[model samples]
Target: MSRRDFIYTLSATGAALSLGACSADGGSAIRFGYIADYNGASLLAIADKQGLWKKHDLTVEPKVFVNGPVQIQALGTGNLDYGYIGPGALWQPASGKATIVAINTLAYADRVIARPGINSMRDLKGKKVGVPEGTSGEMVLNLALQQAGMTMKDISKVAMDAPTIVSAFASGQIDGAGIWYPLIDTIKEKVPKMKEVASTEDMHDHIFPTVFVSAAKGKAERDRKVMKVLQEANDWRAAHPKESIALTAKLLKADEAKVAADAAHVKTMTTAELVAKTKDGTVDKWLDGMSDVFVRTGQLKKSPDPSTFYAGDLYTKAAAR
Candidate 1:
């Protein structure tokens, strides 16, 4: 895509999150890929503010994409050294375009926002629902629908980027949404009549897992070092939620209040917490959940064994040090 097409796509997602600027480094530094939303790359943004990259002596450049699929496509072109993607884009790794160097943050933070008079998930049948394709938003929507004894077939599904979803919901163009912050917060601020019909918080069996992806060929040890920095940042964010939100708002050029609203949906884990989760098979299970959604959504014909692309053993070894 050209610069104009790229900018337009990013804006349409409604995150308006930018990683500042990039350089013509010519392979001098790692071209780090991240989604252009706080939800997409919040961990890395926090690490950047915390000076973890410099502390680790790792050179990484932030390249912003509208969503995980775009990020994965860039990864395939030999541009991005590594990237973080939500469950919606997990198919990329399952197909061998990239490898999961580290199981990224795991969470259950999405909610269904509906126009008033729609009191519960059951009411969504035949109603227009907007969600970004392959997003945790969609994952949450699917689970929420299942809870109501329904599926995507029950609702009029409209695939949109987060920004477009926000616009449509705010202007009464759509009936509901399965989107995350800061877009969710935007709807709350602008559309007073909107009611939250469902939250992933109530779904114990569902998890929105994202992972750090490297090109199909990546340095195992080096990726672990990068994972170390991310885990440290994750731990730090867990300990300082308010500061993390403030820093994210400043970084995204977004409102502090809106970013703060996102805390309810974000769950940051410490290294010990991650170490524990990794050992218990929780990470593997979530990876399965991620890949399963793509197949159910008809994005992938077959999802490779989640373990086939997972490099979590390397993460456990890194944490041991």
Candidate 2:
């Protein structure tokens, strides 16, 4: 097979991923930076609550950021040994320099809620929608519109975070809004007229949701130990749900009740499941679908090789033993 094709093939099977020629010998302490938002924060919480670092013979320091962009910037600066973030946020940085190492969470928890009178995406035309511009919600909104044969230009894309979106949506500043849960739940309860119109689930398959990526040059890439630790952490979280939720609440400053509710919605897969699904037809379908949407929405210049951005070996080796 050609080099690119070979890489894609191996990535599909979870084997023979390309790695730099250095050893990851001494880097045992890993600094995992994440966002305070639900998804990113949950990952760190899972690791800590499950004692994943101890299980893997490593020390993990989790740092919280405000958003995906800031988290990606931290990765690029060597401030983070690893992190979880929305796949949409990685487009610019991955194209520029960074490399995504593993698929952390394949299922996206983002949901779109529209006011009662607004039933279909067609109704969104000329309506105001709240989303953090250049975020996963915004990207998903673009895709949802495309699926309906529409575009962002068809509606007003208002820039706001989840909290602001919640408040504005309540006051009718926006006709529709996109946010993740418990916010989605909270908003729906507060605005009884609001209803869910679309969700990441409606898109059909995993859109890589949020991924685990490292900088072009981080110890996670060079050290097998670091990779093993991360894998063990994944395994731990897969085994411990309650503790993970509690830790998640502490870090997010959210209620334990809501944190538990969110945990049910977050389907954290094992390293083995990730390796298998990503290796076969599953990951191919996701990447192809994502590429189509990105190209359609002008998010990408051209179709670049998605496999080039992945390091399948770490996940592969972790799964092997």
Judged by TM-score, which candidate is best?
Answer: 1
Give the per-residue lDDT of model 2 (tens digit) for 1-321.
211111112123211111212223344456665654445666555555555555555666555443466666777777776766675665654464566666666646677779989998888889999987556777778777877788889998888865678779888889997666656766766688787777877776446456666776645434465556556667766787677667666655566776676556566788778788767857556666666666666766765566666666555775676
Question: Residue pairs in steric clash, candidate 2?
Answer: 12-279, 24-222, 24-223
> Lowest summed-lDDT stretch of 10 residues in model 1?
1-10
Per-model TM-score on C-alpha atoms: 0.83, 0.80
| TM-score, structure 1 vs. true | 0.83
Shift in Å, residue 59, candidate 2: 3.4
Each model's lDDT comes to 0.73, 0.64
> Candidate 1 residues 280-312, lDDT tens each?
988877877767767776767876676678877
Over 4 Å off, model 2:
1-30, 54-58, 205-208, 220-223
